[model samples]
Target: MAITQIYLNLPVSDLEVSKKVYTAMGGTINPDFTGDTSAQVVFADAIVVQLMTRETFATFTKRSTSDGPIEVISALAAGSREEVDRLADAALAAGGTEPREAQDIGWLYNRAVDDPDGHSWELLAYHPAGGQG
Candidate 1:
């Protein structure tokens, strides 16, 4: 079956604090999917992220959440290098920490930022002609 949407579920220690970080990264909260224990952050119509309290998320599986290590790294494609920089700046201004400096590979640019809960996000922009312009 074809998939119309994708939901990335993450466990957070505090919903309100996590909401601020996601909002800074340009995500909107979907009221229909948000509650006291969990909040649904929508990046676009097709990409939805569900942020649940560790306790609330535990109900879905037996796996224990780990805060000391990153289990996943998420990447978002931007329209331009400027857009990627803007997003990375916003994340840092909103209390997210940068894991490393931005990377420029001629045709591609990328930056990584970690949320307050330590979830890693990579913002990237790619140019087909090596950004000669």
Candidate 2:
């Protein structure tokens, strides 16, 4: 199946601060979808993340927010290992937390970072050099 677009909604305590963190990590804010309670953060052409305030998000679901445990780890493919490191570093410098160092396993490299709101994001790159496919 070919998907046109994907939007991941996240509940944040501070909308503007979340937008800033995402933008610092190379994501773009879509002013058309941004408002006082929510902001659309676009990472790629088809990937858009909606950052909504806790109060605003509650309108969509009845479940309480899960900001403590590891709810999810959103991973995106990078152009190269350098790009992975760069984006991860940017997130860390902009108030995001790096849970661990970059992992390189011959054909794949990955790094994880948690945004200020405790949203985990893993940046990864695949190198086909030592692969047996």
Candidate 3:
């Protein structure tokens, strides 16, 4: 069969704060999940994540952890440049912090932010050379 959906499981220090910030950025919280230990916040049909508390996650993974910067570049592609800008603004307004300004990378434009829990997210707009404006 084919892979139908995906969920990015991220570690967070505080689930409530993280949920608020993500909701501010336009994600919806799924109510079907039973407990506060984890939440499924949906960004798109195929894009959602189970934001888990550090203690809960550590126990599940059978490992210990420390608070630190994200080691990888996690990204979300926006529907348009305006959408990218809107998300950046909303994220900041929701207590998320921008790590840097948006940049034009010739074919793509992007900006990055650190969520309240320190998970990194890059919002981007891509324009193929021959595509419509």
lDDT for model 2:
0.85
- Cα RMSD, model 2: 2.5
Q: How many residue pairs clash in each candidate?
A: 0, 0, 0
Per-residue C-alpha lDDT of model 1 across residues 17-101, encoded as one tens digit per residue: 8888888888999999999999999999998889999999999999888666667899888888888888889889878899898
| Ordering by lDDT | 1, 2, 3
Best by TM-score: 1
In angstroms, give how far residue 54 of model 1 lies from its true place.
0.6
Assess candidate 3 and give its TM-score to the true structure: 0.88
* Better by TM-score, candidate 3 or 2: 2
What are the runs in model 1 whose C-alpha is more than 4 Å off?
A: none
lDDT score of residue 61 within candidate 3 = 81
Task: State candidate 1's TM-score.
Answer: 0.92
Candidate 2 displacement at residue 17 in angstroms: 2.1
Whole-model lDDT, candidate 1?
0.88
Candidate ordering by TM-score (highest first): 1, 2, 3
| Residue 122, model 3, lDDT | 87
lDDT of 3 by residue, 34-100 (tens): 2679888998999898888987778768655587655777788887878888988988888899988
Q: Which structure among the candidates has the greatest lDDT?
A: 1
